[model samples]
Target: MLKHGLDPADRRRPDRLSDRELADRHQAMQGFLTVAGPQLDQLYNLVGLSGCNVLLTDAHGIVLDQRVSDGDAQQFRDWGLWQGADWSEAAQGTNGIGTCLAEGRALTIHRDEHFHTRNTAMSCMDAPIWGPDGRLLAALDVSSARADQTERYNRLISAQVASTARAIEAVFFRSSFPGARIVVASDDPSEQAMLLAVDRDDLAIGATRAARRALGLEREGAIRPRPAADLLGRQDDLHGFDRGERAAVIRALARAEGNVSQAARALGIGRATLYRRMARLGIGDEPARLSHD
Candidate 1:
């Protein structure tokens, strides 16, 4: 038998919301929905093929928008799994949105994993969506049936959905916080962080703080005066490194166990370049690996 926590069969109670609280959540969702526009439609089209039901929920866990397969929507609605329904464990029982918010992390809740008996037939993957200041703004979830679900497949789809959500957030931040400084902080300081500061025209004006920290700067002033590309440690010979570069660095560090040489080798970049990129990206230093020689 699988261990309780490891087996994904654990039951968790939901937090019940008052009518007044629900009304407030509804109002907040309406604000977000008004701004959703084309991006929401685009996301619906992109994830339509995963045979998954997509939902956007406010930080409070009320569903704002739901995009389900045409035939499946009715069935889900009949089951009380429809647009505007609450997905938080507190209101609806143990569920994806509630558990994710409760834990404040990305999660996958598989068949029979929910605390509520009614949710046993569903599998869900959810990731928190953050605002420019890194506040929990919303959650993006993809839910499917248990009949054809696998842990691996759920993870894959969840990752894709999370990536799309992140892209959307980047756009949201650019639009909502124009000319404001934005930084991404990680638990692992060695991991490259991204700093984005856009001008009123939606063009990047500066990238400090998180970007400097990603680049391994010790003092704050080290990166304040430098160009974003220079801080990122990209060579003048090459074009600007995009978002993928930061993702690659994070992946390499994770895979190589924070060994600079190993990560550089895995990334197919010279150690110097990797070091420069790390410094430019605001990745903190990892423990030096002992030489085998």
Candidate 2:
């Protein structure tokens, strides 16, 4: 359960925060306030004109920064929206930030969908930000008037919030874990494998467990960080070598049931590479057995 307060509808209002609670939170957030600059601007621009109230919050749900169009900003602030406000369920009731943290999932809450009394007039979408180590770092939210929102709009807003959160996470990962090799994979499984910083010796790292499995690593323990050479098989045929570019290609082929062209596109590789790899790996031109059926 989330430690923050419950949704407004779930229970009666608790007494306001004690002085100590306020002081502790303020002290805990000094570092974040200092470093938040261009990223905030970027987020503002990303969602500024979308008729939504965008908010950045700490892991614990304290509102760190907010960006709404000039027209909406004043209204939102007048409604008690501002820095230092806590939107966690404990503070503002069952809303995007609190529920996302509680469930650890991207969420969409339309007006009246929120579990808190004060939030009934707003629709919100939120995504939880995760650090490279998979820690919950923060939550990004886009809230707006419920009258004009739809499921599709909610999805688009949530996607934007997720993207922004990921960008921030990437920056955070690069700065805090300078020596750690970082690999950013698309949430989409079919895209060609994009590998970053593969040459850094100290940052040597391998794909995630899922990526290793996709690459057909026989043993679980064999998936540790190693030279890129160790992972790629022979490079005799250009086509074959190209298909072997990344594990994502192999996974796409399997998922597509051996549809070469489809797999190639999903892996973000040329069709020729798929064919070449098929030949090199001894995979037949004809679809695999399952596809044949």
Candidate 3:
């Protein structure tokens, strides 16, 4: 705080963005906000009745949206926890929102853990949210100034805050690749939301941060396109079956005279499943015309 020239005893509120600047920032994050808005509301619904307020902030710690009860709005506003408030570590010292963004992690700052004396009455639990491209995107925070709030209760809220952040990241990732198929890269609950986006040709198009880390992709940038089967290390029968499955599919298609539905019936598989198998085996729509009937 000393290096930042902040006095721990200072009672002045943190600086805020002007209406014009705030509007511009909001516009910049409009897409993410649109996707994450429902998750934010769900989080608020979970904790709002407990005398807590839920806030979502951009990577710079400027509050983008907040949910607070009508009765406690003035108290939270007076404490500089409203929209447009600047809570970057340089501005607010070691508070939850600022510190979570600074450290890129989930944590709790309870009561006097606040750097500013006036903010000591509030307790905050926060988690850092990652964008679809694996960069720092935003922070999700739950805060309370209730006199009866306990550290134990804050810990519980902290867990929910972290979970909600991951949910937002998952929703944003899926929305980012509207045409791609999302595959769960990991079944571990700890790796919940570890997902990969694969195109129609089974080429990996994108990955969530956890998926990127799990699959050895670059940690902080766009992932290069690669074969999803290669990344997943699955035994795709295209080459692995040594032409057996491919030959069988070819024979079936030839027998059906290029009608995919008829071929699927001969192969005893669903038409969509046959199409997927054909795609996996590099089969084209123009099947061999072995027979007119």
Pick the TM-score winner: 3
Candidate 2 local distance difference test against the native: 0.61
Report the C-alpha lDDT of model 2 over 1-293, residue by residue, as the tens digit.
Answer: 24553445544432334567756765775554444446667767866776778777777776766777878877677555556666676566667887888787788877877766666777778887654344566778878874767788778778777766655655554554456555544446432222222433422353433334444543333234554544544344334345445344555767887777778777777888767766666665653342421
- Total clashing residue pairs per candidate? 14, 7, 0
Q: What is the C-alpha lDDT of each candidate?
A: 0.63, 0.61, 0.88
Give the Å error, residue 146, model 1. Answer: 5.3
Q: Write the per-residue lDDT of candidate 3 for residues 83-102, one digit (tens) a residue.
A: 99999999999999999999
**lDDT of each residue in 1-293, candidate 1, tens digit only:** 22222223334323335667656776765645555545556766876666667887878787667788887787566555555566765555557887887776788888767766667888888887665445667888888874877888888878766765665565565566555545433445432225556333223344333443455643232223334444444464333464446657877887776777888888898888987897777666755632111
Q: Point out where model 2 deviates above 4 Å.
A: 1-36, 179-293
TM-score of each: 0.56, 0.58, 0.83
Best by lDDT: 3
- Give the residue spans of candidate 3 off by over 4 A: 236-293
Better of 1 and 2 by lDDT: 1
Model 1 Cα shift for residue 274 (angstroms): 38
Error of 1 at 229 (Å): 9.8
